[model samples]
Structures are given as C-alpha cells and as structure tokens.
Target chain A: MVALSPDLTGLRTPALRRFLTPGLVALLVLASLWSLSSGAAGLGPGQLLAALTGDGLSARDEVVLYQIRLPRLAMGIAVGAALAVSGALLQGLFRNPLADPGIVGVGAGAGLGAVLAIVLGGLLPAGVLAVTGSHLVPLAAAFGGWVTTLLLYRIATAGGQTRVTTLLLAGIALAALAGAATGVLVYLADDRQLRDLTFWGMGSLAGATWGKLAAALPLIALVLLMMPFLARALNTLALGEAQAAHMGIDVQRMKRRAILSAAAATGAAVAVSGGIGFVGIVVPHLLRQADGPDHRRLLPRAALLGAALLVLADLLSRSIVAPAELPIGIITALLGAPVFLWILLSQPSAARG
Target chain B: MLQIDDLKVTLGGRDILHGISLQVRPGEVVAICGPNGAGKSTLLRAALGEVPAQGRVTLNGQDLRQGKPQALARLRAVLPQDTQAAFPFTVAEIVAMGQDAGDFAPEPGLVRRALAEVGLDHLADASIQTLSGGERQRAHLARALAQVWQPVGPQGARWLFLDEPVASLDLGHQLFVMRLMRRYADAGGGVVAVMHDLNLTAMFADRIAFVIGGRIAACGPPDAVLDPGLLERAYGCRIAMNTAPASGPWFVPQAAQAG
Candidate 1:
C-alpha cells in the first residue's frame, strides 16, 4: 500500500539506457589510454605500442611502462571489478538497492587488520615476519576480511537461511566494533606508523606489483566467474526470501554462496588496493538506476563501469596532485558522495530503506 | 491433498500457533479467517515451510520438510501478503521468475497466459515497480499461477497457499482473482487462502476455518461457520450477520452493545 508518486513512468530513460555494455567498454578503452599517457613518465601511445611489441625502448621506459603503470592498471581493474560486482551481489542478497560492501563490515574489517599489522608487526614472531615480510599487511587485511565476514554471516544466519536485514544491521554494528579496534591500534602507532596507516586507510594503488596482482588475481577472477551462475537466483531473490525459496531456489545455499562470493571478492580487492570505498555502492546504484535491476545485465555492466571509474580515479589521484599522489579512495569519495546524495534526494522512498 | 497435523509455532519465545491442524483437498478452496495477530499468516507460513514449527506438514502423503526445495516448488506455490519486489523488473520478467524453481524448462506461452488470467496482459512490458499496489498483487498472483500453471503435477494435486492475495485489489480485480482461484480449483488444484473479508470468504471458500488465539476455533462449510456467536468470541467484538438474497452469507462488525 503506497501513495502514488508523480514519476509514474520508470527511471530508465533513453539517456540512462545509452551506456549498458558497449558504451561502457568504449569509454573504458579511452580512459585506459588517458591513464597510460598521463602517468609521471609520459609514455605516449607510440612508446606503449613499442613496449607491447618488445620493440625499441629505453630500459627506463620499459620499467615505467611494464613494472609501474601496467601493474597499477591491472590492479585497478581487478579491484574495481571486484568491489562493484560484490556490491551488486550484496544489494541483490539484501533485496535493497543501497546495500554495499561497507554495510557488511568488509572495509572496516580490512582496515582493522591493516592497522594491527602496521602497529603490531614488530612484536610478531620473526619466523612469521620473515615469511610474510613486506606482504604481511595485505595478508593480514585479507584474513581480517574473511574472519569478519564469516563472523557476521554466522551471527545473522539461523539454520540454513540468512536474514538479510539482520546481516545488514549486524554489519553496521560489526563495522563500529572494528572501527573502535582500528582506532585503538592507531593510537598505539608511532609517527611514521600513523602516516602509513592514514595513507593505507585512504587507499592507494601505489603499492601495486606483479607479485601482489598474481596473488589476488585468482580470488577475484574466481568470484567474478562464480557470479553469473547466481544471476537467475539473485534475480529471484529481488522478491523476498520466502518467495525465492517458494520459487524453488535453495534459498539458503544461494545466500551462502552470495555472501561468500562477495566476501571473497571484497577481501581480495581490499587486500590489494587498501580502502577503496564508494565504487561498490556508487557503480551498481548508478547502473541500476540507469538500466533496470536485472542482475544479468546489472552485474556485468557494474563490473565494467566500476573498473573504468576506478582506473580513471587512480589516474586522477596521481595527476591531480602531481609528484604527491592523493589516495584513490579520496578521489572516489569526492566523486561518489554527491551522486549518492542526488540519488537519495530524488528517490526518497528508496532512501528510507 | 495438503495436510497439517499438530503444527505448533513459537516466535520470539512466545507461542504463536498451538497444535493447529487442517487439511486442504483438491477441487476446493479452504479459507482461514481470523482477527489480527490471530496467527492466520503464521499458519500459512508454517504450511509453506517458510517458518519453523513443531509437528508435521505433508503434501500428497510425503512429509513437506523432507522434500527438496525444487521438488516441493513443483508441487505447490505461495503468494505472500507483501508483494514488494524491490527491483524494477518487467511484469513479463517477474512472471518468468515463476519457472526458476520448476523441474521443467520454461514455456514462454505460460507467462502470457498467466498474465492474461490476472487481467494484466497489457502491462506485461511495464515495470513491476511502477505498478500500483493492487496491480503488483495481481502480478504476484499471476506469478503464483504461472508457477503452478500445469494445474496438476505428477505427484497428487498441486497446492496454492495465498496469504491475503486480494487484500490490495479493488472490487472488480478482487473478484477476478477469486474467480481465477476458483477456476484453479476447478482444474483439480488445491488452494488454501488466509482471508479477512467475511463476504468474500463466504462467497468463494468451500470451507471456512475461524482462527482465534493461535488455534482453529471453528471450521466447516460457510453456513455452518457463519454464526455470530463464534465470530464474536473469536474477534472480541459484536458482529452482525446477514444472508443475502442471491449470495449465501455476509457479516460486518457491529457497534459494541452497552454492558
């Protein structure tokens, strides 16, 4: 029972429908080119093509193009794709368009782990330190994400069914808990440690490397590949859980897989990229508003848009404050917050939920 | 046939249903009517295995809890009171979701036929989120109809559990849904509805089960269960009962008589 709103026609106008798949891919290519050209080392298309073909290029150009920009670009694509797809999966799971990775404590959980590693890494055993070495922070962050996800999911689910509302509320409470823990860890950090913590909290791809990408790529790819199988199930889930079950979806199994996949994707992305916020929420929300909420179209398109947005944002982070990069997270937040407010203002009913 | 035997449900550590028992047979519509918070919806949920409960619910002599979700989906469909599909799915797309749980592959014509039966054939391309509440309810009914479109299953008889299916509809659409359910029953399917409108229940239901305090206080044919005393006791209000010239029985709440 709802009072009729004035906008009786749907939100999918022709303008909104213009960027489904092909449009997004085309934009992604242009953005990627722009990113490749504008880095600290200005490697134009000729140099990029030379690097690609293993043609005539100086060793410095080779290092910048292959070691630095390429890895960062690759990491951006993986992290962006992961976060956006995870958000779409979550929104579908919750049966609410506003659901995001942060709603489920993944971002906070990863932040807490990173802070702990930064503040407490010296106190850890030598064998553990030796084994992880420079990779200790990302490893801890990923593990923290996994633990928090499992805990939140366990607390919210009873028997086989996951309560979407409960998961959301629990996530909020868990995020607060993780935040307090992160704050305590930050308080204990030295000046240099605090600086590292702040930069990591804000998020960056500055730490990108072939090794980190290699480690995280499999997890991100597996989660993305697993998502299409869930498209129909998630579509049915748009109706409430009971109807989903009544329609013959193993509602419990679907919920489990969705949560796990989202967690895995978010964990991998956060581990590699630090705290890149808003891509998850902003990309999917914008896509759903533009196109209809068909997960079949929504998920893949969100992935493409998310990858492009993050890649472009990463470029801005480096170029906006040249020689001293702004954190990618800050760029995304600056861009995303206004769009989020506009969406809420326009769709007041969706905002209430 | 669908049978509920000694089904007890407790929510938030409070008993909501106490050993409720009922049977729904093919070719008949059984209406469960009760006052607010009388466990009418809870009974329907328990019957559909959407909620946890004690005791046994069986469809065609097979225990409902033991059946796989896919297997049970083929045998029955449920239409809940809240038809809030959050996504902006087209009516045709929403209707097609009915086939997701079925054993057989999707039949495109079934979606169209189900939409037509609910008088929403013209709005098949419209977004479900843009439709009025009543229209959404009809679309959900159409979804349920499309789910059990075969009308008969390899098992015994297909069952439909509707919780206030027509609560949001106008008079014409309400009758349209009722007739559709009637025809569904006529086609050898069983339907159990949680109802509120006494007149519609009297007109449409083959049998009435008056629920009170989480139990079936009375159940029988329309005339047999239409007594004002039973309704008054169940609803805690005075009720005026009347028989229509053409229809069978109708009832409305009366102002409290001075003690």
Candidate 2:
C-alpha cells in the first residue's frame, strides 16, 4: 500500500548494517573460544589450544577437554542460536517485539511433551520404547511444539489474515493450557522422574553430551539454513498481509513455513537444553535497535548474538556458584527481564498502537 | 481491460455487494463514487479478490481465479485504504516490498523513480513509523506504483485499483494524487478509484460509476451521471447540479435551500 512521491528516488546504503553483522559473528567466535577454555576443571587457554591442535594431554584432562566441556559448549551454541532465531522469526511473523518461543507457548508445549515422555515412558509397549529410547523425549517434544504452534497459528489466522492482537491472546491461552498439562504430568511423576523434571525445567547445559548434540544439531541446522529463504518473506510481511500479497508474496505460504520452522527450532532447543529463557526475545530486539528492521540482517545477527549470548551465559552460570552450578535459565531471565522492561518503557506508546 | 460481471459479496451472512457489473478500459480513469456505507470499498476489494465473492472477473480476457497471485500482481496493483506498517522498516525497505513478490529483484532505479513520483525521495532511508499519516499514504502509493512500474504483458497496459486514496490527504495532496492517477491513465493505463469527493471525481475521472444500495445506480460521463435527482435519491438528501467554468461539472447540496 505504498504511495508514489515525486522525490523518492535515492537508494539507501545502510552502511552500519554491513559492519554490524560481521562484527557480531566475530564476537560469537571469540565467545566460543572463551567458553571452550574456562570451566570448573581449571582448563585454560593452553589446554584449549593444545586440545584444538591435537596435542597430547593427560588422560583426565583429555576427558574433561573433549568430553565434558566441548559438547556442552556446542549444545549451548546450538540451543542459543536456535532460540534467538526462532524468536526473531516469531517476532517478525507476529509483528510484535515481545513475541518469543516461551511467551507464545511453544516452550511450554515442548516441556510438556518432554515431561510426558519422562513420566509415561514405562506405559508404552516394549517395542515402541526400545526403538524410541533416548530419542523419545526430543521427538515427543518436537511433536508437542508442532501441535501447539499449529493450533496457535490456526487460532490467530482467519480468512488469510493474521492479526497480532489475536495472536498474542491465543499465545497466552495456549501457554497457560500447556503449563497446566505440564503441572498434571509433574503431579503424576515419582521421585526420580520428579528430579529429572525439576532439573529440566530449570534448564542447563551440564547434561549435554555428544549424543544429545548429534540428535539436536540436524534440526537446528535445518532451521538455520532455512532462515535465508524466510528472511525476504518476513521482511515483506512487515508491511501487512494484504500488501504483501499485492507485492506477489504468497502470504499464506510464508506464514506456514515461518511458523513451522520456529516451532521446530524451539522444540529442538527445549528438548535438549530444557527451558532456557530470553535469548529469543532479547537478542533480536537489540539487533533491530542497532541494525534497523531488515530481516535479511536481523535474522542472521540474531542467530550470532543468540549463540554468543548463550555461550557467555553458560560461562557465567558455571562460574557464578563454582562447584554448585546455577541454572542457565535463571541467568537468562535475570538478564532478559531488565531488557524487556527497558523495551517496554522506551516505547510506551508502541504497545498501545 | 478489467471486467466484473454480476458480482455478489456476502460477509458475516450479510449481503455487502448486490449484483453489480462494470468495465474499465485502458487510458481511462474510472471513479466509483457513492455515499458512505454504499459498498464503495467493498466493491473494489471484491474485484481484487481480497474477499470471496460470487462473480466473474477477467483481466485481459484471463480469469483472475485462474492466474497466480504473482502473475496477477505484475498485471495490476492495489493501493488499500489502510497503509499502517507494523514494524519500523526503513522507507526504502517498505517500498522494496513491491518487488519482493515477483520472481526477480526489481532494479533499484525503478523503486527510486516510484518514490520520486510520490515526492518522498529524500526519506528513502528514514523509518516508515516516523512518517506522518499523509506521508505514509504517499509512500504506499509509491509502493503500488513500483509494483507494475512497467507494462510488460501482451496488452502493454496495467491496472490500478485504489480505495479512497486521498481520504487522508490535504487539498494539495488530494489534487496531487488525482493528477497522478490522471497521468497514469494518460499513459495508456487503467485506474479504478473509489472516491468520496465528487468535484475531484468530475475533474479527473473519464467516467463515473455511482454505487447506490450496493449497485451501480448510474454510470457514464461526468456531465451525464452528475444528475441532481439521481444523487439525491442515492444520498437520501437534496443535491444540486452545477457547471464551473474551469472544473466542468460539480454538485452542490440543496439541503440548505430546502430548509
């Protein structure tokens, strides 16, 4: 619905956008290195460098370097990047700065799905449990996310139009529904199952292993690679659905793809890392403030920033309480809550509009 | 050419558009004028397929339903009544959305030309959220212009459907946009405009179609259709027809005279 003007001919260069993305990527790389080196095991840059260079190390140090810390770092990066990019997608798709996996119920849905698998695993037939062993939680979690997202999308959309107000309302309803279901699952669980549920709800990278990483990496990578394709559609969507259709975007198709991808990425992240909070909402909003609202730049920058922020948070979580590790979700919420308030306070009028 | 025949639209189980028929030819500006709630905007939207309707619409002899949205977009463009942007996209990025629907990237020069046509060239990098309502309306017009910037089909003519485009504009901008529509028509394009201002419609429209009670009550040249009795009957108020030396035909309400 853009109008023509007599003097609207100049092309915008967006100079800062060029530098901001690469800078974030570089920062993420440095953060990754720092995370790889620092830990409770007293590993330093020397050990990290030696490990990377394939230099020989003492057996115990080698186990700590290769097994304990490396997979955790990889899991942190994957989960962080996935959550952030998923947040960016949902925000763009919903046209709201506050939209995130957790707020929209995808996280709670995944959590419920994983909880079900944990508490109800013994009831399934031997064959189904055997084949789905170790994989059951993630698969169930992904299915949970998919169903909830599909329901949310359906509820928010009608007659080929998606309203942000309706979406947020539906998200709230769905999140509450998922939370209640998870609570019911918790009540049914025994002591061991209860401990697992509690730990998973708090979120951590401490349980990360190469096997979990391998299980989640493929889904996360698929969503990440799909971002480039989704970026253009999401950008056009900012103009509203009717105008997007007028410009030749298949608005329905774009909505379907974006919702599914966000659900998948969020599901995988929650499946492996429990309930890490704020990465999705925080990173994307900050990047948009710095880089403008072009999804081409926003999505990738969100991915990198999400990766870096999670890695840095993981480092803090491990070191903050020393031998007794703090939940990563706790750190993210503390960090994110302030930023969320700042965003809300800064644009008091935007929410009203 | 754009054609609609016997179109009927029902929304929420209420009939919005009764059986209606009309045709728009190239190199002409056709204004669909009516009183408020006369289904003026609904008529335009139904033809654009934004809402489901029972009708037959054809563009250049091709049924609209048979064509893909992308293909139809290349042949015709629409400027809706509301142009509110949700995100704080830069003006350039917002305008660039017109090109994103097609298979290939639009040349940056075309986008600039569209913006320049709407008189918003200097604000290309500015955020759309910062623009005033009138400026945003112009920006949206520029986007619509950028969509079918060139007439590429076999007919070598494009169609523009605008719904009360100048409803939010000042007097100067109202004429500016009306003149732009006139220019687009002069360049062998067709424009279907939903207008509330009768004087402006008489000045720019090659033909006028008066919608009353969800139907085309009158359709013809400005002089022929700007009849006092027909307008009075349509508006449920007294109307007077007048001729201006410079503006051709105009309408004046006779409510004061009756009182």
Best by DockQ: 1
Stretches off by above 4 angstroms in model 2 are A1-13, A121-133, A156-169, A346-353, B102-106, B152-155, B254-259
The residue-by-residue lDDT of candidate 2 on B1-259, one tens digit each, is 8889999999899988998999888888999999898899999888877878999989887676446777887888888887767667778777777755533254758778878888899988888877888889889888888777764445568888899989889999999999999999888888999999999999999999999878888999888888887877777777777788999888777656332
Global lDDT scores for all candidate models: 0.81, 0.82
In Å, residue B49's CA in model 1 sits off its true spot by 2.1
Docking class of 2: medium
User: Which candidate's lDDT is highest?
Assistant: 2
For candidate 2, give the lDDT of residue A341.
Answer: 64
A1-353 in candidate 1: lDDT tens per residue? 24423333366666666645889998788888777766767678888777668788888887887788889888888899999998888778766655567657877887787678889988999999998866677667666776787787678655434555577788899899999998888888999998877656657899889987886777788787887888988998888777888888887788778877877778778777777877888998778667777888888898899999999999989988898898888888887777655544544353353
Q: What 10-residue stretch in candidate 1 chain B is worst by lDDT? A: B99-108
- For candidate 2, what is the TM-score? 0.93
